[model samples]
Target: MELTLKGLHHVSAITAKAPENFKFYTEVLGLRLIKKTVNQDDISVYHLFYGDEKGNPGTELTFFEIPMAGHNQDGNNSISALSLRVPSDEALAYWDQRLTEHKVEHGTITELGGRQTLSFRDHEGQRFILVSDENDKGVAGGTPWAKSPVPAEYGIVGLGPAHLTVETAEDTAVVLEGLLGFRRKGTYPSTAAGQPDVIVFETGEGGSGTEVHLEERNNLPQEHLGRGGVHHVAFRVDNEEELKQWIERVRTVRLPNSGFVDRFYFRSLYFREPNGILFELATDGPGFATDEHIEHLGESLALPPFLESKRQQIEAHLKPLDTRP
Candidate 1:
């Protein structure tokens, strides 16, 4: 069967503080809070989602807020950075000024794969890049949030190339190429000395959100999953039938995957790549508006049918979060 993974569906991370995470992504970064939900697997933790106005698949960046969690270690076998697409070089400059005015720590603009990028870390030290794609190949476009502090023209487009740090790229390359339909695009010099070259992989089409860069760090220590670290990076699949095909493909390749799991908003199949980073293949249907009306999204806590019985108990344990922009 052919693989139809288009681009990123969402990049989910862990945050140690709920209030700070809520403010940083919604206010500082200017993304809309699309869903206020709890982690179905662990109801005590809050699973908050932020994205474009309509909660489009590629625009999403979610979080599992757990105040007790510790800091994450920087090492191999992890997603080190997430790149967000912007419209042009002007947008990059706008972000530089905006971040500085807000007292956010960010680096000056730099070039990566011929594109201008501004690197910054969130309050919890999760790295991110604001990249300009004037050609519009990588990030098609999306609806801007009506209440965002950043203007629509310069707002974030969507999730772009995400950096995956691994000890060796050989086995992971096979999964990306053979099973996931990603092709080897090109190579770039590693940022760290003595590290293996960084390999670029393109899925569907060779554009911004469709690229994934793998950096092989052979001598680095294994990383522990905790706060400020990526929990999983989900790739976009069109619907249920396409999602089913992927499950069968995973079985044929003998990769251990969590067979179809319905996440009320979308269905998902979770698995780990050879290098140990959790990867998810999620469908793009019944999106954030399935339960609540479009105008009222993220205003209240939402729960799937199975968790309805425990809503009261869950709500009691989870702290109240004010998601105002």
Candidate 2:
């Protein structure tokens, strides 16, 4: 069967402090706390998800909390930065002032790939760029949560282009093109001195939400993962059958992968491209609404069926988390 990746599913990153992370993402950023769950593999720790109104597929930005994690040491072969989509070019001005009022470290508004953007780092140095969806045409953005601190017009709508830094750009390019079916979109000048222009790639319904910007730097060392570093980036598959087909496609290409992981909200397959950057293909449905009603998402700890049996033990290990929203 012919297949095309729908768009970005979600981007998972690491956070050492779950409580503080929650406050920043929810109160400060105006994103909705859609899920309060534990990392499936490490039930003692948290896996928090933030997004627009209902935590739709492309809108999710998740974080796995590791209390003792070290600071991230950035370099090549890493998901260097992530972009969040805002409604228009003018919104950049609003965010610039909002971020300043909150004392969040950020850059002045600038242009990248013909779109206005504002770069910033969270308390833990998690890098992000707010990309304006001013004239964007594909993969429509999500609806901002009605109760967000920021007004709907200025709230973040969804995930945008993820930036990847690699040493051998061609190796990663091959996987993006041949294996993942992404096409070269264009290029933009690199912010770093003496570095080559970053290459852009996109998949289905090409737009900010469906793109990846690849930056190649040969002189840098590999990144050492820790707090504030991205764990993986996932692309969207339409359903379980399609996810299974994608699983087979990954295996057929001889890439070692996590076969079929049923994440409850979505089913997925995990793999790594040649540069050791983790990638995942996830489905869009059997979504967060599967276990909890949309109205009460993130209000309490949510356990998948398999973990329900250990709820007592799991709750005992986790610190008190107030996900009031």
Candidate 3:
């Protein structure tokens, strides 16, 4: 049986500090901090959830903020970058200056996909790209970030699709198109976004939202897994049974994948494409509120039942932040 992934879900990253990460994504980037908690397995570290108002599934960009996490080199076995789409060039310029004024290090605006983009790094060194798409899907349903300079109408819709840079485009294509159920969306000329060949896919709609891109960097540097490096790219599946189908299919192709991980809100299985970039098959069930109420999200330290015993130690280690926007 084939596992038809619904679409690209949330992207998780590794961060070094909670306060700095919160400040950049929520304050500078204007995303909402939806959940505040610690990693269930290792309670010493904090797992942060940032996204649109309700912390919707796809718009969320979660992180594990480990103190002084070392940096990784850019090579194979890592995700090079993740791109978030905005509504227009005005948004790009707004982000460019806003980030600069906050003393955030960033690069110049470049033209890509027929739009201007502003590139910058968060405190953890993860590089982010903001592109202005004229016909992009507007932000997911939710209240606006109170401090967001960008109006609620033009807030971040979701992942403009993520970039997986690989050594050989040939091997990566087979899995992207064949196993993952992604169709060839289109090609684009080189843009300021820094990739040569841009091939896009849509498990849902091909509009300016819910898409993923495969960037072929034939002889470029490989990415190291460290601070700022993406941990994994998760594809949305309907439920646990769907996730199981994916596990079986991936194994049929002789690919190695981990068993289903109960992530509280969703179940997941992880596998890598030919180029060693990590990919996850996650269910879109029992969402964020499976554990707490939507209005109370991120208001307190939430621990999974198993990790409740260690909450005291976990709370002591993490530096508290004024999570209020």
In the range 1-325, model 2's lDDT, one tens digit per residue, is 7889988999999999999999999989999999999999999999999999999999999999999999999988999999999999889899999999999999999989889999999999999999999989889999999999999999999999999999989999999999889999999999889998999999999999999999999789999999989999999999999888888888999999999998888998999999999999999988888898899999999999989999999999999998884
lDDT of 1: 0.88
lDDT score of residue 248 within candidate 1: 90
Q: Tell me the spans in candidate 2 whose CA falls farther than 4 Å from its real position.
A: none
Q: Could you say which candidate leads in TM-score?
A: 2
Superposed by TM-score, candidate 1 places the C-alpha of residue 163 at a distance from the truth, in angstroms, of 0.6
- Best first by TM-score, ranked: 2, 1, 3
Tens digit of per-residue lDDT, candidate 3, span 1-325? 5556666678889988788788778767778777888876577788998777676667778898767778857665456677776766776777777778998889989876555777877876787787677655533323455556567656775666677677677688898888877778787764435657677666755544456666776556767577788988887788888788788888888898887788776788888888887888888877777677877677678777667787788878878866753
lDDT of each: 0.88, 0.94, 0.73
**Candidate 3, lDDT over the whole model:** 0.73
Off by over 4 Å in 1: none
TM-score of each: 0.97, 0.99, 0.88
Candidate of highest lDDT: 2
Candidate 3 segments exceeding 4 Å error: 1-3, 137-143, 146-150, 191-196, 321-325
Compose the digit string of candidate 1's lDDT tens values, residues 264-299.
899999999999889999998879999988888898
Better of 1 and 2 by TM-score: 2
